[model samples]
Target: MSVDIHFNASALGSIQEVSLVLFKSWSEKKTLPMKLTKQGWKVSLSLPAGEYKYAFIVNGGIRLNDPEANAYAPDDDEKIWSVLLINAKGQRLHSNQSYRVHLHDYSLATRFDGPGLPGVHKQINLAIDESIVSRFEFTQVEGLHTVTLAWYTPDARLLQWSDHYLVENETSAPIELMFRCQPKTLMQSPLLGIWSLKMFIDGAFVLEDDFKVVDEEVYSRRDFLGCGAD
Candidate 1:
């Protein structure tokens, strides 16, 4: 079977060579033969459907993470991504298909907003879901601060759905308004899976937008302003 792995490195940097290895189990022979390309990489091998462990050997000796994997590991403060190989016939080979993986630096910076701030220094506790699927941080400039949260899909598709909370003295505070700019794919799900915002001021609801559900990916800016004060 031929498995094609495609990736863009113009965002990360020109890569010299890439290496990959597949392990049949925790204590099995290691399969380390894959090819690289200008766009990504591909491999041709004949193996039965089963759970496998893999890793990326970047350049020559640098071990890196897989950008396409579905799961990730937090080891020594490092992230790793992996994928599950299944029979083309759609039969379950392994009970656990969820693999931990990490995003390439290029993909992370280009596809998502960064420094997680609007201006100068600020104290923020950036939290992400266990899947590392989303991130939250706070930015401050001259004592004026705002919280910014971001989410993304495995394919580097930005998830438009998100929420930010304003707190004062360790308690939720009222927000004046909230705004978000996201891609149209969020409208694909009947539930408007893209980014969303919820605002509250003085312990009361100020504004909320669930977003319009649609069939296509629509990139647009949504604003919620002039909410009431309680």
Candidate 2:
């Protein structure tokens, strides 16, 4: 099913051009030039059911994110854009651990001791994140499960980690996998902005999430934040 997606541009007035860039498309044609309308700058795309990484190319040089997009993701150049999650029936999804195939529960947070350990997924501390984990629990599925976690830096570098598990619906129980990141290298001052994580089960797209990389203290007065979930 193909859904009609309407992208209302941010009020970046008096710009020369506004083009919509959709990454991870099924076809080679990804970028779509938007048109101005009475409702301001807008673009409409007939997209299939899947997750799309997108951003707005304003004036052909400046890359801007759809402020009102479902979510935001950073590209290879550390340029922050937007994310569009489409379900099978052409509905927009927020990735709040909704009805996903073969997935039971998914949670993301930073390892900072506070009133709420690893507070929210919005802002992450760069200094004191000695232990950060991405946990996922899968429903009972028989056979060998190979899960791969791909991490992307703000500037679009890669750090990948994988885990293998055996499970049976009748005989074996399941344990949530903790994909830990190199805190000293990952959460630091130099690497600050948006970082993304992709989970692939048996070479199939299972789920994806993004987080902002910031420089702040575990219990400090101010907050140095990155990009994602905003």
Candidate 3:
């Protein structure tokens, strides 16, 4: 069987150190093929049909959650990572197929291709349950930028509502709405903010926007309550 693992560091310029452990029964042992790269890491291993446990060691200890891992083991302290066991016929041999859960029907909306500047604008419309839930005014800079929108549930857990925006060329370029994330609870009051903006064009850094996040009180008192609440 072939196994692949991938992951990325949480912060820019941070080096990710990693290790892989393979276990079969309590005694069976083998070596596996592994490789690491700038984007993440990958490993390929061949094994007999059976159950096994693998661990990823990173930063001097075991790591959790391969961002690119498609399998997971439920652990309270860590997000699960994906794993797969395949048969000689190239079919996945790990069963319990009836209980598998899948996520669908999630979406994000934003615009690309805007004038490149600090206040260049675009709008984002979000709808849920057939109702218009929220709208966003995205301001673009000359390079890469991140916007963080967050809210709190009635239960008081802070939830993130966010996306990334990239401006590829200095002139008129095709921009992307790129990534969008939706929090699981609608009961949470939605809060939004532009967390950071780092811009680069023609392979050189041009500008950076790392503003002090406005105090939570400002968002709490505002008339807009995020994407889901009136």
Candidate 4:
């Protein structure tokens, strides 16, 4: 269904453009330009029945998580943002786990979406949840090695991977790469199936995760047919 999302930035009278960057799960990222209204800077979108996280991009430079948003999540860098739940039924999606580090007194953990939409860009993402916020610090450190993110199909067919290599030590540094690909390139792959993501450190394997690529099933299902029980 469609919802009217409002943001109050009238205090910044000189501000001109305000864009809404909505991310359903971590995969689907849409940038909608908001119009200044008497109520506030607002925009309407027809989102499926599910949870979403959104932030207001002011002047295409500053990214402000909704201060008014009650539900929230943190990025890889521990920056908390506003999150919204559409048709939630107390169903938790991902499993959380913790790991101990040997040298840096650091522990690593990761969370990901259970399933995603058709577009590849919106299909898979790497994120850290709230449980490990206090323990993991993503501060940059030297002696980091090369990092790469790769995507693969369920049957182990490689679809597309990140060409840009990040030179940082995975063990000493923090994992902050959000793997995204071109919409057209991802669309060429199977629309409905399982996909996987593999992280490589200096050409050696690190960790792997998987997510489902469901079509309209995400919307057709009962969980998404309506908002939470009322």
lDDT winner among the candidates? Answer: 2
User: For each candidate, what TM-score against the reference?
Assistant: 0.35, 0.45, 0.32, 0.37
Least accurate 10 contiguous residues by lDDT in model 1: 101-110
Candidate 2 matches the true fold with a TM-score of 0.45
- Among residues 3 or more apart in sequence or in different chains, the pairs in candidate 4 whose N, CA or C atoms overlap within 3 Å are 27-122, 144-168, 144-169, 145-168, 145-169
lDDT of 1 at 84: 51
Q: Considering summed lDDT, which 10 consecutive residues are worst modelled in model 2?
A: 111-120
Error of 1 at 99 (Å): 12
Indicate the TM-score of model 1.
0.35
lDDT at position 74, candidate 4: 59
lDDT of 1 by residue, 24-71 (tens): 654674646467754566665556676555655545543434545443
Taken over the whole model, the C-alpha lDDT of each candidate is: 0.37, 0.59, 0.36, 0.50
Model 2, position 189: C-alpha lDDT score: 46
